[model samples]
Target chain A: MATVALKSVKKSYGDINIIQGVDLDIQDREFVVFVGPSGCGKSTLLRMIAGLEEITAGELKIDGKVVNDVPPDARGLAMVFQSYALYPHMTVANNMGFALRLAGVPKAERDAKVKDAARILQLEPLLQRKPGQLSGGQRQRVAIGRAIVRQPKVFLFDEPLSNLDAALRVQMRIEIARLHSSLAATMIYVTHDQIEAMTMADRIVVLRSGKIEQVGTPLELYHYPANVFVAGFIGSPKMNLVPVKVQSAGADGITIVLPGGGTAMIPVQSSNAAAGSAATLGVRPENVAISADGPIAGEITVVEHLGGETLVYVNVGEGPFITVKAGGDSAANVGARVRLSLKTDEANVFDTNGAAMVPKVRKPLADLEKRGH
Target chain B: MASKAQKKIGLAVLGWVVALLVFFPLIWMALAAFKTEIDAVSSPPKVIFDPTLENFNAVFERVNYGNAVFNSIVESVGATLICLIFAAPAAYAMAFFPGRKTKDLLMWMLSTKMMPAVGVLVPMYLIFRSTGMLDTRTGLVIVYTLMNLPIVVWMLYSFFREVPKEILEAARMDGARPRQQLLLLLLPLSLPGVMSTALLSIIICWNEAFWSINLTASNAAPLTQLIASFSSPEGLFWAKLSAASLLAIAPILVFGWVTQRQLVRGLTFGAVK
Candidate 1:
């Protein structure tokens, strides 16, 4: 039960700045995930908060007290690294109880705590085995069990499931979500995979090049991203961002010319939204459909059939290639002519500065979840 | 099938030839140790002779050979422990928290072993004589410790490097202090390397001849000096020399043969595949 606040946190090595300046407030029991491309300093930010890396300049407060100078062990935080850095020489039971032993916890008490953590992770039978003796997934569980025995105020996971196979990754993801709900401890997870962020986090902090792009709930980020970067980063087959000319801009709507010489009026409110200027139209895969007389025409480049849905890649001339989510049994094949129609009300418009023009009104949570965008 | 069999037999023959060549000198020495002085030095070398243990009895009865053996064991073991005490912390620092000059510092430490030991003979003798440490086991221990320090540190540094850095970070995260990190994590993880290093240091210290022969007369004499004494003005008694040499080297030879595998592993600890 702790709130972590970073005020203008910055990390730089000599002249090269890694994390420029990050200011974020993490409330107690919030599952905040930092998602970004590789080299975006997401891991660095998590490390800084875990006290594993030094903050070049900033004030970090945890539980309403400054802890920038505190060592990791004294900061009341447990971190599970990408490699699951378990002590290779130690048995699973001893590995989990190591921190307790260091704190002078009595032998019986330490054993009970270890047993509890093992039971939670379902690692009771492997208690006496060393790390080398366990499988990769079991070792990963032991790493988490080690952290669980600490019972820290905050749990920091740095791409903890990245090394696992696909099936194990999915299983571990659900288990981690269950653990978060069961423990009700604040967790800061960092991953480049958007689905993990969308499925697990209460609030997702999108980062790019050492700066936070946006911080919002999954639905808010999906339905109303603050900018083009967030729009392009949040969903599965990323949102298609196409450069187009702004035909006209008004207080209630902005009309942008489409690639095939058609125009659609996007419902956004921007006081400074101008006409005869450059802008981008952001459309998610699910928000665009194939129609016989749709404005945008293109040839299907590829078709991916994912059982219930098929992602058809269409290359409309003079704009970005667009992916349209269609019914799996639809007769969309490579080289077929595809006409794409946008759901205009759900479409987003970005101005010359790449900032998303604010929506006229927020969508209801039920409506947003029902669309499953 | 015929060519493969021929190749295998040829390789086997070459391997035996190499092994026999290496073992010839030790075999000859062993044979001479059990022979009388006359049979030991006979022309064309006696291939067959009556053997006796009188030469060993004479070696013990004539000189204080027991003192030399005791001194050798104490000096070698003491120097090995002292060198380990000095090298562990140094190697730990160089391995985990390296700086810009770390590589240069490691190379400099290893380069000290390249220079000939005879080059420092005069200066070392002068210092030992002036300090009244010329004939003491303590002096030999200090010399042997310095002699073996570089190799010990180098081996340990490489061993420590092979251990993943995340393990140490895990210990640090688990509230282990630096001393505890070294004792609980590093010492156990690299026990084989450390054991090999200690064994090498003991062998080198036991077999060292230059400093022992030049600086010590009676009290600090080790096995090397005792073997050298067999060549005294007795007109080169081959049987007595061989018996003394065998006695002085038997323990270390057995130790080397037993631990040869670990030494090879230590030598090639981090070799790239």
Candidate 2:
């Protein structure tokens, strides 16, 4: 319904800055997720947009109007806190209708709105129950219902699924995604879970230490992280980064000596750093495969079997052991030597300053995000 | 197994013994309230005696206790109401909107209670005397309200802290301003703690002897001063004193008996994590 924008928004207490100059624009009906580790100012940024926290030194505009000084209630927004923040004394219906009641909406209209939200959240059966009487997932739904009933310009969620168990988290994640599509309202979600961001966000903003590292579609971030931090933070089982000595730079790519005395030509623009210099090679575990004739060889240190896939940790003698993803039925065990091959075009090279070197030609993956697989 | 049973029995016996020991004075007083003066003073301390209503009759005839009772009720109950009105908001600010100095401020508020009230007696007496409030219920109410404010605020602050900060933030997001947040949400949620603090304040105000004794002669004297007034030049009138003690404690005992559960829970609930 509305676009939210932050321009050079800074949050600081005395000299200790929290959100250090964040500038972003969220479009109408867009589901944007701010993803980062703890203490990364993601929640603070969400709160700043919700007007729960003041913009320290920058403009915050909602729907093209500067709302830097507007109180939270006046800002036309709602937030679902990690704890749900459900009123323990109120029934589910009352909890959902509270903002309406506070705004002096008539009882009939308030009840109708509450009923509508409850139906959407599948909380009709729980209308008469207090928050304490509900399960964790039910409480979470009620919290979302509370926010939804407000019908604010933008909905803010601060780690809403953090309290849910894994199975419930997945269920709730899909439900929330469904809610976003149905409502078609602008949403800003803050979470430390990369999987949640990747699954639900139209655009993901990766942040670290109060600064935005990169912002892109999830697949874009997955395939083309701008820096080492975004690459490391976006993937689970993280992208393996190994220190390598650059052998040569050419029109084709830069040839680098891999961690375990193997050589690979990474297809990225060199921007001309002299050969024999050190750089980092970035590779995802899924791209690293075990083959008898592969160039790099290392002993398997640990193996994690997840029913559908196995993760084999290999001690490659130079880096924090490179991990290789294998089939669930693979018989890779600790202490076995495995030769590894990589998808050369997919590999990335980072200079010593942790900036990913630009790829010469971008691979055009068609409708990567829309593909169910 | 036998030793466990013995230990259980031993604990029960010990508990009862301690209970009786603590209740001995009140039991003796209740007994003596029904005894004749001579019997009450008997060296053996009469456990059983011919019960008479003479001491109660004497108290009724000698003292016009209605005025004292009214004064006690008005002063204590008035101070408690005012205390609630003033203290709840202060506690809310301290608990929910805490600053870097909140802890220091709480400690400072509590520290005011550490200085003896007697230390400020002469100045307070002079101020009251000059202000024409020396023996008035208004004066005592004012003093009691100030006297109990720090503790009430402290109690209410702790109670308010037990509420999740997110609930208030939700209320704020829901468009409830500061006053509405306090009245609609916080007060209802912490009703038990608020009630316990009020009861404790009332009891403290009711039993306060030093202020009432020092500040009043007859016009605004409460049950405490009335009980003290029973002391005679001849000797302590044991039966009459006992009768007045029972009379003074009767209403408060009932008040406490009705709401003692809240008092216990509010105080001890937060003692642990």
Candidate 3:
């Protein structure tokens, strides 16, 4: 295993900077994912690390060597493209064994490596078939198998599962997770889908406009998002941000008034801003409870039944709608008035500049159950 | 449904009629190849006559037809192979590794083909005479290679563009160097296109009458020049001329028939995709 570091890496196409001076340290055998929206530089960052794109400035190190100018093939890393990019003319065995054959490895060793990878990917039956003869999922497996035979120091996946169907994407996602653990190699995955980042990443680097926004474990990013962008991006249904103003400040917490008559105290350090400043009150959808009795009430505009959980979108007056997750068995109809309450501890507060103000907590499954929302 | 079926049948009949109309001239030419001097020139063309092999005998006896055929084979085939060798890599670079001026370069190359062949005819003749290349097969081969290179490069470039760049990049990621990429990836993927291009270049070179007529006399004369030799100031020599024309076109006709499928398939493959 080798540690990969990008020191102030910057990339530009013409005058438009795509990756603006990113510095990251990926520990050996760590699975790091770069996650961001489209037009963000996450994919560009992954390509620079793969030696596919040139770095406009700064250095990239792999295995303690400054490899800013090294070619991709000589860098001891293999990349699986977003398209899979299997050789359409070659059989599965040949496609998987191509790198070794190019390296001038003996026929016996190359064949053995290919066969071992085939067994791992369950591609033994497809050894003689071309990519055109295989389904999309099988072709992706062969693409992964091609990388495995190389035994590289790092594996790069550029949205490898984006082309597959939803069912197959989930299946392949699990397969990749298992493969990463079994091989114990450093993997850097780039994807726009936050679900993949949250589910598969050891640590996620969220990027925005070529700058690194936050780098943390999946749970860390989920709980202690560095800004409003990460706060909304990391969670499903996104965090609800209602405009609020700091009415008063005390040593223990800051008192904030909602749009209507309700007021709440959120624990925070307000040294930067005085009392009576505008801020966004951030709370996750899961933290908002649809109760029979609470401070605020609104008519349900939409109800999504997902079998295990139901998301209710409530159009509270003047402000943006709030989403609350309730039991799937809950029979809350659309246009029905429902009361909503925010769980105080689960609530988070952000300043006018979109920076979070509370300490994040990682409650175990047991701890989450004990609180009983 | 009935109307559609009737339209299909009507179109099929029209197609057959057009096809037969196209074949009529070649059929009459082959017939004239077997005719005597008088029957060949008959104004109301003799549909049925006692055919003789005298014209064929005269063709073989009067000129070294076998040597002419061999010259045609060597010149056309040699020129085609050379064109492919130069054009394939140039086309690959133009298609895949293009720069800002690639399209302009391709257009410039194609424009050379549009230049009137006669504009340089006198200069070329004088240069060949001075170089002692007047009656040499190499002289003819050089002319044909130049004539075919632009079209050959254009055809190969178009075919290369149809191949997805992802395949080549995938090959590179598989650690394939330049040579391996050409041999193992591009050549295999674009075989049909390259095959059709080779066929077209060979056909054009084989039928090149201008250079063949002016550049060579007896020693290096190709079939086209051999056919041209049948004309004299004294008379039209229709019977002999017909026979030579038939002989000259037979080889290309057979070649065109053999590769017809591949040529049509390659040409149409781009339209649908």
Top lDDT prediction, candidate number:
2
Per-residue lDDT over B34-90 for candidate 3, one digit per residue giving the tens place of the 0 to 100 score? 888899888898989998888877888899988998999999999999999889889
On residues A1-373, what C-alpha lDDT tens digit does candidate 1 reach at each position?
Answer: 7999999999998999999999999989889999999999999999899877889999999999999999889989998888998988899999999999999999999999999999999999999999999998999999999999999999999999999998999999999999999999999999999999999988899999999999988888998999999999999988989998888878768888899888888888866867789899999999999998788999999899999999999999887789899997978979988788999888898888899988887778643463343
Model 1: runs farther than 4 Å from truth?
A270-276, A366-373, B1-17, B233-235
- Give lDDT: candidate 2, residue A259: 74
lDDT of residue B149 for candidate 3? 93
Put down candidate 3 lDDT per residue, A1-373, tens digits, no spaces.
6999989999998999998999999988888999999989888888888877889998999988999898778888888888888888889999999999899999999999999999999999999999999999999999999999999899999999999999999999999999999999999999999999988988899999999999988877887788888998998888888888888877667778876657877766655656789888888888888887666678899999999999999988858998888888979899998888888666778888989886434355332242242
Model 2 chain A weakest 10-residue run by lDDT: A364-373
Each prediction's number of clashing residue pairs? 0, 0, 0
Docking class of 3: medium
Give candidate 3's whole-model lDDT: 0.87
Residue A61 accuracy (lDDT) in model 1: 95
Pairs that collide in candidate 1 are none
**Which residue pairs in model 2 clash with each other?**
none
How well docked is model 2, in DockQ terms?
Answer: 0.73
lDDT per residue, candidate 2, B130-156, as tens digits? 999999999999999999999999999
- Go through the candidates in order and give each one's C-alpha lDDT: 0.91, 0.91, 0.87
Model 2 root-mean-square deviation:
2.6
- CAPRI tier for the interface of model 1: medium
Model 1, C-alpha of B231: deviation from truth (Å): 2.9
